[model samples]
Target: MQTIHINRAEEMYDHPPIALAVGFFDGIHLGHLTVISKMIEVAEVNKLKKAVMTFDPHPSVVLNPEKKRTDYLTPLNEKRRIFEKLGVDYLFIVPFTSKFAAMSEKDFIRDYLTDNHVKEVIAGFDFTYGKYGKGNMLKLAEDRDGFNVTTVSKKALNDEKVSTTEIRRMLMDGEVEEANAQLGRPYKISGLVVQGEKRGRTIGFPTANVMPDEDYVMPKLGVYAVTLKQLSTGETFKGVCNIGYKPTFHDPSKSAVSIEVHIFDFHDSIYGERVEVFWHEFLRPEQKFSGIDALIAQINQDKVKAEQILRDMEL
Candidate 1:
């Protein structure tokens, strides 16, 4: 897919007319995919380019400046990868800033949607745009612009709406399996392995400590069944990941949380290597052990649980 970074819609005027699916598309969940699929269908039927228009920095970051940080389900690069896999022809990334947020509904429609050769605009039913979110599907449908608007109805799983917020909530609660069901894939986080004190090595379960990317939701403190994929080699390994503050080996100076994964049947010094961990199941919460022997025994139990879960998943 071709990515077009634009500060203004005029930048997209030269491209072919497009059937655009516009939204934040954070998780690219089933609901978001419905809109994109419609855009693709519309484009195929109308002979227009299949396109997606999303924003950067997230609208909440600009609209609610005091919020400090906004965690995303899929970062820009990940979104691009998913879009490409879904067969999108164009991906337009617009910078979300205070000025852009202040654009009037009429001006946004005229300058952004209409001027960019958007023959048909597709979005989720709840999607809103323009200053103060004054633009809605009803208003867009009522507009006399030459382009048409398509609003995909809410998509659900087990009677609950599939949404990025819900997925984030599940991850925060360590409900990986349910979140993956809604996401249509395992929830993944990528980061480079960093050096640690080699505490795991002493226990016969050497781990690669990962320093995760900022602004991505961290799962609840727990041991989880996961698949660790080394980005450089594309080699995947079954693993058990622990997300915690490591209370078992307390150090007052180490207050930050850590993500350490112990890959089964693997032994390598992978410090500084990039890897992506796909969370499959939540095994148990992080626990403080009485001593080194107890900690090792509990880790062995956690490994058994993780292995069973991984076996059930057939991954």
Candidate 2:
């Protein structure tokens, strides 16, 4: 997919009319798929180019000054990967700057959609845009001089709405399985293996210290059944990951949370290697063990549970 930064758009982008799915698409969860599927259908039927329009930095980053936290389930690069896999022809990313947020709904439609030859736009029922999100799906269809709009109704499971907020809550509560259910896939994150205190090797369980590549929403402090993939080699391994402060060795309040993954039956120096970690299941909360021996024993148990979970998942 060709990633286009709308804020830096030029007239050279002239092309055939496109059917665009518009949203921030933070997680690209099942709810988002509902809309994108419709967009794909429309684009194919009308012989229009397939495209997705999203925003960067998230609106909350610019609109809500007091909301300091900026975590994303799917960062821009990851989002682009998904779009390309979905066969989207174009991926439009609009910058969510203070100046851009102040624009009116009409100006946004004319400047971004119409100017880019967006003939059909698809979005969820709750999608809104323009200054302070004053534009709703209903309003978006009105004054449509050059485009038509389709609104996909709320997607839900078990009578509960499938939303990013709920998914984030599940991850924060260490309910990765449940979050994956909402996302229609396992929750994955990308990071680079960095050098650490090298304590795991002493305990007979060597680990790769992972430092995240983007501002991702971290799950609860605990152990998880995961699969780690080395980007360059494309080799994936089943593992048990501990995202904690190593409370058994240091003060939890003082140490920052670290990502330590023990690749089953493997040993190699992978520092500086880029990898992806797919969270499959939550094993247990991080706790302060009494001693090194106690920690090692618990880790052994964690490995047993993690291996079983990964074997069952087979992903």
Candidate 3:
């Protein structure tokens, strides 16, 4: 997909008229996919390019500046990858600024829709835009400058709306299966392996300490079954990941949470290598163990369970 950063809508005027799916699409969950799929269907039928537009730094970053950090379920790069995989023709990233946030509803429509030659727009029923978010699907359809408007109803599973916020909540609560179902895939986090104190190695379970690449919403502090892949080589391994403060060996209050994955049957020193971990299941919460022997025994049990989980998943 061609990624374009839009400061002004005129920047997209030269391109072919596009059927656009516009949203923040943080996790690209099922609900977001419904909107995007509608865009793709419309674009194909109308012979328009498949396009998606998203805002950077999030609208909350500009509208509510006091919130220091906003974590994303899918970062920009990951979003681009997923969009490309879905066969999007163009991906527009608009910088969310205070000035941009202040743009009137009519001005926003004219600039981003009419000026850019948008053939149609696909948005969720709850989608809003313009100053103070006064622009709704009803308003967009009523304006009808040139482009058509499509509103996708809420997508849900088990009566729960499939949404990014819900996915983030599930991850933070250690509900990987539910999050994965909403996402239509496993929950993944990409990062580079970093050096550790070799504590796991001392206990015969060497681990790769991962440092995440972006502002990702982290999972609950616990032990999990996961599959780890070396991004460059495409070699995947079954693993048990522990996200915790190493309470068994250190004080939880004084330590930062760490992500350490013990790859099954692998002993290579992979410090500095990039890897992505796909979360499968939550095994147990992190806790302080009595001694080294107890810790090792528990880890052995974790490895066995992780192996079985991964095997069943593969089957």
Task: Give the TM-scores of the predictions, in the order they appear.
Answer: 0.95, 0.96, 0.96
Best by lDDT: 3
C-alpha lDDT score of every prediction, in listed order: 0.88, 0.90, 0.91
Cα lDDT tens digits, model 1, 174-287, are 899999999989988888899998999987999989987645678888899999989889888898999988887876266788899999989888888988999999999888
TM-score of 3: 0.96
Model 2, backbone clash pairs (residues 3+ apart or across chains), number: 0
Write down the lDDT that model 3 would get: 0.91
* Candidate 2 vs candidate 3, lDDT winner: 3
lDDT of 3 by residue, 1-315 (tens): 799998877787778989999988999988998899999999999999999999998888887779633788898888898999999999989998888889999999999988888989999999888999999999999997999999999998999889887898899999999999999999889999999988999889999999989878899999999999998888888999999999988998898888999999997888999999999999999989999999999999999999988886661
Extract clashing residue pairs from model 2: none
Model 3 CA deviation exceeding 4 Å by range: 65-69
Alpha-carbon lDDT of model 2: 0.90
Q: Candidate 1 vs candidate 3: which has greater lDDT? A: 3
| Predicted candidate 2 versus true structure: per-residue lDDT over 204-314, tens digit per residue | 999999999888899999999999999999999999999989888888879998999999988778999999999999999999988888988999999999988788655
